[model samples]
Target: MKNIWKILMTITVVAGAALILSTAAFAASDSKTLTINATISARAELVLAPTTINFADNSPTTVSSVSADNPVAVTARVRTGKATAATLTVASANDLTSGSDTIPISAVSWTASGAPFIAGTLNKASAQSGATFGNGSGTYNGTYSFFLANNWTYNTGSYSATVTYTLTAP
Candidate 1:
């Protein structure tokens, strides 16, 4: 009888504790999330070293401009993304020809040395008194700008001078 009473008391206490806990309510909440992504791009442009140039006395005048040889303006430019240095060279190609009424080319010669007169000193850009360009990539890829000597000997006809350029990588 004593043991039966103790078991009954324990069961009654546990039931009372469970009933009190169930009576108490808990708060409820909800949440949401949002996400986004990004994109990007880089770019560059060609940089002309000698953007523009002018020859001191390139205009060919029969009598007045004879004494002095016409100076050629060389334009060197490049496009780059990284730091670099490059060199460009100009050489003359002897493809000179004359019209039917052609005067022998041997008789006439330009004051400037066999093409690529290179002004006073050549084979060096350090002597460039004119505009010089570099993109840091050390590579120059673009059209070369220069003035042809105005002094010429002919019977009145169109003439041409061929020039070749070699670009070097840094």
Candidate 2:
């Protein structure tokens, strides 16, 4: 009977110690929860007004008269947003076509009032090497003058070319 009591007491003590250790290990840790967020902004944009330019016919009695008053003016309004720098470029080949016949782009030239460059000849290539309009923000109203000096005789018909103006924000 004495041996039985001693064995029971030892088993009870071991069980109690294991239970206490398990409870302490589980209670030592903690947990929490949170949230995250994000957003997107607007990009750079440009707008041009008076997209059309029309030059009236000038009757030249002499080559001097044609050369004297060959220049015509056109105004353009540029409105831009969210930009660092912008450039005004034109097509290199400013050609006027009728059926199978055509006139060369170099016959006409252009000059801008507030442009940061000297007057440049129009062409039919690409629109990269034109002129620097300016930098920063807001709207800019600029006038561009086109001139065609009558050094040679052109076939008598309608002579016109569509000029494309591109405002690139870089």
Candidate 3:
């Protein structure tokens, strides 16, 4: 009986040692590396409220400048480099015309209410900068109150002109 007990104890110790060693061997681990990539491109967006603006007739003597009924609300969004600049420009297709009469587009101008926005006259020959933004991605909001220089020399007939606003992000 003593010899049997000794053999059992020895077998148990050897089995325990074998189990611990097997567990350590199985503990070895390996990991696979994964790479991730994303792409972001430059983008620009612009919004103008009340696309059509009306300037009511007024006596040139009473009002030197005729203001539009409502100021235009503007919103500009841009995604650009940290060092790049964004710009908003306005250009007229042609002078205001009514039959054989005409009024120079430059007679129209605007005043802005927002940072970086500037007051400027409408130009038919070239684009005029309405706003200039410093580096980065952001959304800008502002208002443009337009006016037409009232002059007695202007034609008596109604005159109209088309103008375009452009936003650029680089």
Candidate 4:
């Protein structure tokens, strides 16, 4: 009887210890919170196909205006506020020049084929708007056909000029 009682007591103690350990193991828990953040800012991109354009000589009487690389493909991408406006502009470095002879930059004008794009003449003193967008975060595609007014007064020589295109998202 004493031996049996000892064994039972030992088993009860072991089982109680195991039950307490298992309960502690099951009840133990730890956790930490995590925070995430994301940010988007204003951005702009402009692309032009055939960065260089050439004008072929023609009779001033027969042709009132000369075409130079018609239908220049243009792409604009922008990211801005929903109510903010995105703008694209072009500025001429200088008038078409061959030595001392020159043609006014204003003589060069373009016709646009796209919404929000407007027809405008090249300007050396000021930037000309190529396109304007009321909505934000979009890709706009368009074409610009350039024309130079042909005049008998122009000095005949290879003439060239540089123009810059700017896209702004604000």
Q: List pairs with backbone clashes in candidate 3.
A: none
124-144 in candidate 2: lDDT tens per residue?
A: 775544456555544454455
lDDT of each: 0.40, 0.57, 0.91, 0.90
- Per-model TM-score, in order, reads 0.30, 0.53, 0.82, 0.78
Query: Per-residue lDDT for 1-170 in model 1, tens only?
Result: 99999999999999999887876644365578888876532223334444333324333564422221233333334434455544444444333344555433222222232222233212222222121334454322333334333455444555443334444444
The lowest-lDDT stretch of 10 consecutive residues in candidate 1 is 121-130
Best by lDDT: 3
In candidate 1, which residue pairs clash? Answer: 49-133, 83-136, 84-136, 84-138, 85-138
lDDT of 4 at 76: 88
Q: Put down candidate 3 lDDT per residue, 36-115, tens digits, no spaces.
A: 99977889999999899988999999999999999999999999988898988998979999998999999999999987
CA shift of 85, model 2, Å: 1.9
Worst ten in a row by lDDT for model 3: 24-33
Q: Residues 78-165, candidate 4, lDDT per residue (tens digit)? A: 9999888898889897999999999998999999988777789999999999986878688888889999999999998989999999
Q: Give the Å error, residue 169, model 3.
A: 1.4
Among these predictions, the greatest TM-score belongs to 3
What would you estimate as the lDDT of candidate 2? 0.57
Clashing residue pairs in candidate 2 (N, C-alpha, C atoms within 3 angstroms):
92-123, 92-124, 93-123, 93-124, 93-125, 94-123
Give the distance in Å from residue 31's predicted Cα in candidate 4 to where it truly belongs.
12
- Superposed Cα deviation of residue 72, candidate 3 (Å): 0.3
